[model samples]
Target: MITVSAPPPPPPPQPQPPAGHAAAPEPARGRRWPTVVTSLVLLALLMFAQSFRFPNDSAVTEPMVASGDASAAVDAGSFTVKVDEVRFAKAIGDGAEDSGLSDFAPETEYIEANGVWVVVFMEVTATEKQLTTFESRLDSGDENVYASTSWLYNTFGSVDDGFPPGIPIKGAAAFEVPEKALKDPVVQMTISSGPGQRLAGEAHVKLGLSGDELKKAIDGAEETLDVPAPEMQKV
Candidate 1:
């Protein structure tokens, strides 16, 4: 009586889950499909991006071929230029037309050529009002390069000087190259940003001439050409 004996005769044992029926599995760990797919996609994109490479500037070849007499203009960033005419001669006289050898006495009056002389007439309009320099060369089909001789004598003043914006200056460039190299030629002009500066860009004017044209130039090589004066015009 004092111990209340037997208490409640040990409360009945708690019921256990039925065999083969497990307690609800912890909410199946969240499926990682979304995160896994996102990682795979990012990896694929990265691999694809690394497969391509940009071309090097040095590897770039010359631009499209342009005709010397083409109405289209050649743009060289700092200046826009056009080739007006192309002529050839055996010798170049002292800029003056009627001047005799005596007029240039003491100094050589004409520039004699070992082969033939190539003269290119060009018009250049400066995009910027600044001092700059231009270089020209004649490229032969045979891979020969003939530099312009316009600066050697007083023939045509150089386009490489101070230029006024929106004004075009017309001048001639001369080169002496072997006769065999004259078959098919191309004139190229390189522009410099300023004196002693590196070359900015180049403009190529192709001399698309037939065999007859080349023959005509060669036939007239004996005559002397008077260097024409440069004229200015509106850009």
Candidate 2:
């Protein structure tokens, strides 16, 4: 027998994976820390860079304020106002005596003050168009923000007093506050053309009636001060 059977052809070489296809060794648990640390450093750097910049202007939500003394004319964009006098009164009116109101009313109208009445006489003028509404607020270095009292509706000053363009409406805005509220009293007048008045122009009239001057006003308060009736004529 020619037992010369050709040596079985060497088994086909076992299929070999390409060099790039070799299974990658599992990464050491500690090896991931460098990548995590690098990511953290980048995030911290981003936050640090932001700290050097000033605050965004849009975040300033305070209204634009125009400040002046009692006699000075303060321009509040839509309207200009000039405060003439500030009076402290024990009572506003009595049906027998003058009510400080122009119109006469029956049934014995007497707007007596619980604390004291601070009347601010002012002339308001519209800059662009006729404005029918305005507002006043009192800041007396206290917790309470006193608004105009409704008790003096018939008095010269109305929250919605009409102001024509270029013309002035002379009236008085009244606030009833305690005698102690005289110190550092500031009255703010607000006018707006639209519905919302946020960031709008405001007039901060500094009545030189604080400190020693404040005491004088309290001492010289009228028994019954008369608030001139609101009229179109500028006084």
Candidate 3:
């Protein structure tokens, strides 16, 4: 019977928003799809800019010269070349048996069965007036590379000695390679603009031997080959 009436039901709990505000409209549920799509587009563009930064061996941008017929003339950029002959021997003489070299030795001071000597006889003719040099190497079928021999001295003219324009010179390059590589070998000749400029205006010459031909050459008896003096002729 106190008749307080519960304090008029607490004034009906009036709304609490300030004077002129609409309560921020429930924070707008924010689309979210536009932001996610923009982030993915930016990531795709970044990956597209990184593809062309380096060289790949699988791409061949330059032309390669193919192997030519035996003793056939092939045209290089600065010169014309022909592989005249190839010989395999157990030992290479110091050219002493033929001439003034007699005071040196009868045979190479050493011999080994695990390896053999390869002599490449080539003729080169300069096509231009520029000073040019020649280099040679042997590539086995398995892609092993062997440089020409520096130990076995030869009286034959050196390709390193550059040639003059329109002049032809004949010489031999010797390589000491594993006996097993004697079969199906390819000889590569590189002509350069100068002794120091090995790649400038470079040209390549490739020569290969048939399987039967290489076997016969390797099975031959030991013999002494005289390094033929360089012969120069006008083109």
TM-scores, all models, native as reference: 0.63, 0.65, 0.60
Model 3 Cα lDDT, one tens digit per residue, 1-235: 6675655555777787776466454444356667878889887777776666445643332324544655578776666677787777776644444457656655545443247777777777777765555566777666688877655444232534666777878777777788776556776766656444433333344556657766677778365555544567655
Candidate 1 TM-score, true structure as reference? 0.63
How far in Å is the alpha carbon of 139 misplaced in model 3? 0.4
Best by lDDT: 2
Which 10-residue window of candidate 1 scores lowest in summed lDDT? 61-70
Stretches off by above 4 angstroms in model 3 are 1-67, 94-114, 152-160, 195-208
2 or 3, greater by lDDT: 2
In model 2, which range of ten residues has the least summed lDDT?
Answer: 93-102
RMSD of each: 9.2, 10.1, 12.8
Question: Which portions of model 2 show Cα errors greater than 4 Å?
Answer: 1-63, 94-108, 142-144, 155-159
Can you write out model 2's per-residue Cα lDDT over 1-235, one digit (the tens) per residue? Answer: 5677787888989878657554434354468889999999999999999987658665364457888877689897878888888888888852233556525545445577878899888888888886655777888766567897666654433545666789887778889898876677788877765455665568888777777778888888888876666667744
Stretches of candidate 1 exceeding 4 Å from the true structure: 1-71, 97-108, 150-160, 196-199
Residue 57 alpha-carbon offset, candidate 1, angstroms: 8.7
The pairs that clash in candidate 1 are none
lDDT of each: 0.68, 0.74, 0.62
